[model samples]
Target: MTSFARKVANLLGVAEDRLERLAGGDLSEVLLLRRPDGRCTVAKGGAGIGTEAAMLRSLAGAGAPVPMVEGEHDGVLLLEHVENDELFSPLAWADIGAALRRLHERRGETYGWPVDHRLGTVELDNRQRSDWPGFWAEQRLVATASILDRPWRERVEAVARRMAELVPPDPPPAFLHGDLWSGNILVAGGKLAALIDPACYYGHGEVDLAMLTLFGSPPPEFWEAYGPLEPGWEERRPIYQLFPALVHLRLFGAGYAAMVERLLDQSSRNLSTTE
Candidate 1:
């Protein structure tokens, strides 16, 4: 394989004096390239990363804080490296909230993206659907159920069947950063730097917030700037969390299955409360 850094340099028409690989997760390898002029850019290489450049471009156009895509060749995606300027601050989280609000404002006619992308190594379904609940149930909940053990899989499928009733209807289809965990959130110099490694789609906006709150809680400033979430948002979050928990189960192993089971149980209880 032609090295990712070399491919990126050729595509960007630069002569790199230094190329250092950065620590990325299992799906992609990231390289930091410095040209003789001291300009730095990142090169991401993976088997199926070609669509990510287009996603970055689209998000940038919609005012989301994302890296500017420099170019691409083969599986190497060249993006303008954001220089880390500051640590995370209240103002930074607030800025992220506002920027994300702007991003969600840029909506589509249907729920999904133009192309499919990966949430880790697993395929994320972006096939458009007119109905949001059906999209979530089919694409997110049931589609991910296949990786579960037979009993858990059956239970999850039952939850999917109840999705129409479980989730409220007629919320506007909002753009989503399909995988929006805090790890994908970058901060520099106490300011929001970029949202990286997206699996873009159009769905319920709460999906992003659910993932953000999965590992840790977002600061109060973030919620203040983002505006109040939908009524009963706290209850709906576990249902949204199921997608990523299931993603973890598929990618990591059965250890994550317990988390998925807990979320399923919570969903079941919440469903009863609603009923």
Candidate 2:
């Protein structure tokens, strides 16, 4: 076993019988550790592990399904192993939609999180603001401008300036799973098992929906279970999507530049039509 794994085992006061590495994102290393008593725990080590633990606790407090945090020491976060077959059936999608709806029902006094977070090397600005557009414009859209090329930066700035006209000035500040992609969702037996690896905050709930649809479309069952959305969500989807696209572009390089451009084009077209 690696020293890190041994450290986590010692911290948890468990005898590690076996340790198996699990697939994880660039930001963290994930391992499944089995104890002598046949109990399994997941140990994660990397930047923001403590922040993730806090996010999970917040989710639990808000009645969302998340893995129980066993312990955290140094940079390693230990959590109860959640069983998953990684299957997302139609019913599972509906279940996820319903779960997200229930989560979003819990509102915050303002937009943004109490504390900021990071995704890989990118820093998420979570400074609270009374106006939704101002928060999204400064914190989400324009924050990455320095890392982007001139043309792309200009495009992003244009959209950022039009935030108030494009997005509702005030929507209920619903709790958001800031990163709600399919990969973060774990499923078991055709049902939603848990929503893991959240970059959570309070913002427009549509932000989660937009992120959910960024890489792929959820089935009709999802929308049905999620209930109705405010009008203009279709137009705002690209605007909301731009933040993640920009993050990917910055993290993964030029491969994602096209995605950012595509979203910018869509948002620009929507703005022109409205004008």
Best by TM-score: 2
Candidate 2 lDDT tens digits, 1-275: 77777877677776655668788656666888777788888988877888899999999888888999998888888898888888788999999999999999999999988888988888999988899999988899899766777887788898899888879999999998899999899899988888899999999999999999999999999999999999879989999999999999888898997898899999889889888
When superposed on Cα atoms, how far off is each prediction in RMSD?
Answer: 2.3, 1.8
**Cα RMSD, model 1:** 2.3
Q: Tell me how far the alpha carbon of residue 257 in candidate 1 is from the true structure, in angstroms, after superposition.
A: 2.0
Clashes of each: 5, 0
For residues 1-275, write the lDDT of model 1, one tens digit per residue. 34666776677676654567766556676878777687788888876567888777788888788988887777777788887554668988898888888888878888888888776668878898788888888888888877667887899888988897777765778888778876677888667899998888888888999998888887899999998788889899999999899898898898897898899999999888868
My TM-score estimates for the predictions, one after another, are: 0.92, 0.94
Best by lDDT: 2
Error (Å) of candidate 1 at residue 151 is 1.9
Alpha-carbon runs more than 4 Å astray in model 2: 1-17
| Colliding pairs, model 2 | none
